[model samples]
Target: MNAQEILDECAALYTLPGPPKDFGERTVSDRFEPAAVPTLITNATIWTGNNNGTEVIHGGEIFLEGGLIKYVGDRVPSHFTTNNRVRSINAQLAWVTPAIVDMHSHLGVDSAPNLAGSADTNSMKALIQPWLRSLDGIDTHDESYPLSISGGIATALILPGSADAIGGQAFIIKLRDTKDRTPLSRVLEPPYSLLNGTRVDPTIPPRWRHMKHATGENPSTWYQGTRYNEARKLKLEQDAYCAKAQAHQWTGLPAQIPKNLKWEALVDVLRGRVKVNCHIYETTDFTSMVGLTNEFEFSIAAFHHAHEAYLVPETIKKVWGGVTPGVAVFATNARYKREAYRGTEFAPKILHEHGIPIAVKSDHSILDSRFLLISSKFAALRKALKGGLQGEIGQWYKAVAEGKIPLVVDVAKADHIATLLELKAEVDEYTGKSLRLTLTHATEAHLLAKQIAAAGPDVGVVLRPARQYPTVWDQKRVLPGPPLSAQSSVGVLTDANVTVAIGIEEGWQARNTRFDLAWAALEANGTLSRTEALAMGSSNLETLLGLEPQTDLVAYRGGDVFDLSSRVAAIISPARGFVDLI
Candidate 1:
């Protein structure tokens, strides 16, 4: 078929009609009935939308009907007026938090261990490149998503970098490593603002002009006046090129300009849809750009690699909306030609503390699974390690990790967990539990149980029955009464039992209370607590993103997301429509 005919056929197949005429509020269609719903979920510890763990109901049941959290507190409703289509999961010590929502990332395009080849990632030629959307180059097979999920990251905001004086748009994505039928549907779009662009901020000033001198009786030194004109001409040409680029006015890009892809991207910036992410650090440059940005009517969204943010904190805060500094790029004397190295990470943390609604991101080409979180944590810790106690940012994290004054801080782990938690809490709070829970049985869970049973009959016993007693059962003897009694002579094992605990006590205690001694302990040992490490990978990360976290958690005793060490299997009943790991 001709190209025209093909286009026409495709258009016909894709169009859809608008909403029905009677779609007004007064008239209800057969489309949705809020009253008609079903009951689901049994015996789970729900991290209530609030940040309080005590608010978390342990061993309680939740019922979802018509996609809403119908009955939430304490127990499931005994009576449903309608034929209750019920689904239950034995949430045996597994968490039931919201899904994770990572606020900062570049998952789809730049995968892990980024190499030099992804330079096409940015269009630096143009001072502005707004039209360059990231979704166009997103790779479904980007290894970063899978690696992130291994750390329990569910959703992410994949954004462009501040390469050009202006950057491109941003995209929100889910970290689901599967054969997704629709790639575009997975991305969420929202307007991003780039309040500032990149500027070179130096710690030490360079020796320029070296005392300009003009002597009437100049001596004939070396080349005296020989070929001086030749060098001056070259320098003037170089200066002119820079001057022309700097004088680039939007008065309809020069007609002679080729159809440059970078310029094309800039058109979008001109239209004001994409935010200009400038990499600025100096006060003078910042002042200069503010006027330019105002004239263009485009705002600066973020500032990247801002080393001297503290110098112009108020000015930067007033101009650019956000700042993300490097974690370890400190104590350098390179470009300080004009300004002094005020401090590292001071810009972001101070701004964040002063209510900038900060979101820390790793300015990396390829996504490093742990870099985002680790980088953020390092920023806070480095400040703490430098400021020594007066630093609120470091103290906040230190307190979160039980304030163990460890010699070495696993900033990476702390940062990861922190972001995860923040993201989770945001989602849960915004969209109350209306999740479509699909319980898939993991055959591995059953296999692992078999192996545990095969260990020995004596290995299956529990001396004291705790709240999780039923979950802790000896599979050596399936039947509870006589068979279990007969195996009693073999003796009971505590730690070896496969049963898990899903209580929120630990998570709660970690958040609500202050544990300076604990942090001191970590400091003394040069290590973070296990809970703190886990938080780095989970809670802390979610919190940072300002999105809700999917805590509909499913865990395996023998194996974590990284390595399935145990041979456990989960048997799912089709009739029940859900599976529980026993």
Candidate 2:
């Protein structure tokens, strides 16, 4: 190899990852749309996501021009206002906040409608393929982009699925569609080295690269191999390759730096240039991964779906480089698998009290990224409730006289009451039996909460849709939340000591995450604060995913973001360099 080429390769290996030198001074964003128009939004209540996400500005204004946030305060400067080309929007005291960021998502790769060929989230070719990129699998036609954007998700860290130990490299992307309509156009701060393969321009600082790693049940069940040992062997092989190249062992007339695409990404991870996001659950898995990081002298950015993270804060704090890996988890999604059997709703609060950063995630297709905010709301709800709920599944059925369907509301209410009583009787009968029970879609469960609680603490109830609606004959007596009823079913069940958790019924309901959270807080009767609600959808997710600050903003018209009266008005995205009116 030429002397200059070898020197460049060695130098790039040691280079660290960060933003460009002109990051803050740039007038236009890298993702800016050429057709974007300058926009000014005035008279809004802005949640700037500053001051640890507590900063709010009343009667504020924001100036967006050339895809950058030029001014954010009480007034726009006269110079910007006088520009004839700028468009103005009166938010009319609406709430404006940073657009939501889903840290752990598989939106495009997983794709919606669930077809066989569309599933590209995992590659089963090998258990330890780090060179595979999620970007390559992204389907531009994925139906979730606009849906996620409608839910205020501007940016997402598209991660590979957990089917492999070292699944592949992950990439961050803006959710907005670009004119080019290609996956590459949507990438945010793509690694410069990606353009020229192994050759990078030495002048520009390296951008942060992300990778997905999984341990515990997923890899064990999928590949039937000892994941930790295999991962360790790969790291050793990478170390040898990098060491040989750095030491200039190859001397020839025409030669290239030693490179193995399979292990190259892993080598960068050892050099501390890649942010490793892991999929782990049990405490044992966490300990193994922590030991791996310390032994290899690398760092994990965050642990995704870490149901047991709250149980071992000290162990997480002991990670390499003294940086505790952020814990990203679901708010109440648990117990469907053995690995998450001990998962609790109070995990976020417990971890927070231990000085550990926490974030709530959707896991995309698993929980629907559009409703990612609901996870945060439930997290906050658990914190406020102080670990008072429990139970898994419970069922009740009643026999009615054939063809004796009642049309009257009073008759239906009476029948509903009778069915609930019968269900409670069955619950009592199995109180101490060797059976686990969970009540799903318990629309009228609140009516017999005392009876259900009396049965046992092991019986849990799951409330779907957050709010109850009388969409069918069985749900005729569903408790209407808010003004009609002082408290929602969630409140009644909590008061009666029934373990309750909120969930969505279908994929379409995911877009209503903000409304679900607002309704949950409203039904709580002031126990859940607006700031806490906002964190469930914004800062909390960012912390959990170990992501950089988001620059996209969403404007809600008429009232605060949590208010049902408010509606999304426009989206100001610095990442996409444009203002979009919804």
Candidate 3:
């Protein structure tokens, strides 16, 4: 659509009823199809994406129809058999799990991520440019979406680039390779912020500088040599223009408006409603942004690249916000002093300990999005081994509490939940298994992660899928209670028992290619049990995402999976047949 037409459409939308006054408006119920072909997978270990839990079955068959899981157990009821055409598969080799959800992304919207030639990525014209929208520039034809689809990425929350202090809003999009397809209606609300620019304010109160520069004949000569005067001139013009613009907006009067798109965006931010996901670093910037947020009453959803998040954990805890940092990305002195750069790999762990809500994102282009699972696992391991940094995920949750930071509640060993945390352990524990064993373990891990991540902290099963792709049937929470940490650990054995004839750990390598220390967990090299390890990846990661309870369906290729890659690759759906994972 043309720019004029887009604006006209937006204007017409604004004239309609605004957001609902009730909190119920936030999440609408999902619409399910009634009649669907019945398909059955028999005799397989199942990970009910219900908790930090998995149930191993020798011969289990599940009935699926109308896009909902009718039954997931050892026996299929007879009623489902009478009316529908049943296509049964020997699932002894397959591990089925929910499709992956990428909460933070720039796919399709920013298209190509690099800044060198992309004007669509950033708006540096002003400090607080909120008007810039990534959706306005989404190249739906971009190949990134197709690449993500290969990794079983079912949905992505496409956000604006974080080139500025205030990036534009975010939109959730279904991963589709169709020609001009309509996306699902239940997208997360778009949040935005303005990128602060380097413009100085000319209206500074001059005190000591005037005294020093006062000469008998010349005035304020002390500041003459620097480019301060030029900066001040630009600042004055910007301020005057901003005043005129604000006045005009209030009165609908003619005024001098800035031709700059960046400035125009900031007006939306100041008006509130748009949530800001800032890309900030320094402590000073964080403080300033908080001040701005208070002045405008807009919520700060998160601090995108908060390398300095550790510096002001207390302040962040005050506001219900989050941080999505590149966990392993440590800065080099070549770009800036390494001392100024705070890394993110362990930040989530630290924040969790200090009470913060944490979410992990690939932040990479489409092709490599699946790698996010590995990246998050790395963070979990580093934090867990470091002793003092325990409960890092919990700290993040503390930071996101709406009221005062709650005191740390004593959680049992069974309470330790994070899907990433559990996966790291499960993948490690079953290191050198047969292709079938590996497949069963990986399948259990993926499903457990989904369940733990989908449920919130109340159940102690951490499984927060991306906010965009969370199950929304009737908008009601339908997930069952999660298994305790101990139960979750024992659950892996259930899969291993029937999947393995002798149930011996002798042949398992304890380490494999997918994850780095996963072998130790498999070999019992580490004190943590295989179940405990899986809990870290499955339940812990879920808890970190605030999705403790999950209720969703995942379909995978029928077979014994050696690693996560194979399982991720075996997706077959009508829109995308045989999802490609390279």
Per-model CA lDDT versus the true structure: 0.40, 0.73, 0.42
Which stretches of candidate 2 lie above 4 Å from their native place? 196-200, 221-254, 372-582
Candidate achieving the largest lDDT: 2
lDDT of 3 by residue, 162-280 (tens): 54434455666566543324332323322212113321221221111000001111111222322223333443555554554434343542233324453433333333323445555
In terms of lDDT, model 3 sits at 0.42
What local lDDT does model 2 show for residue 198? 47
lDDT tens readout by residue for model 1, 1-582: 133333332232222222334434332322224554465566788777675345687887766655345666566657742454566667763446665555445676665546555433555455344456676666775656666775556666566554443345566666664344344546532221211231122211211000000111111111232222332343344344334434654244332322334343333333332344444555665565554545444345554344555455566555522342221122222244333344344455666565544444433333354444444454544444333355666564344333222121111121232333343233334434211111011111222333434333311211111111233112122212223332221112112342211112245443312232232223323343445434433453343222256454445457643232533355455545677787
Residue-pair clashes per candidate, as listed? 90, 10, 89
Model 2 quality (TM-score): 0.63
What TM-score against the true fold does each predicted structure earn? 0.38, 0.63, 0.42
Alpha-carbon lDDT of model 1:
0.40
Residue-level lDDT tens digits of model 2 in 441-522: 6677777778767756544555665687777545656878678888788777767866665556789987777877777767
Looking at model 2, which ten-residue stretch has the lowest summed lDDT?
394-403
lDDT score, residue 483, model 2?
85
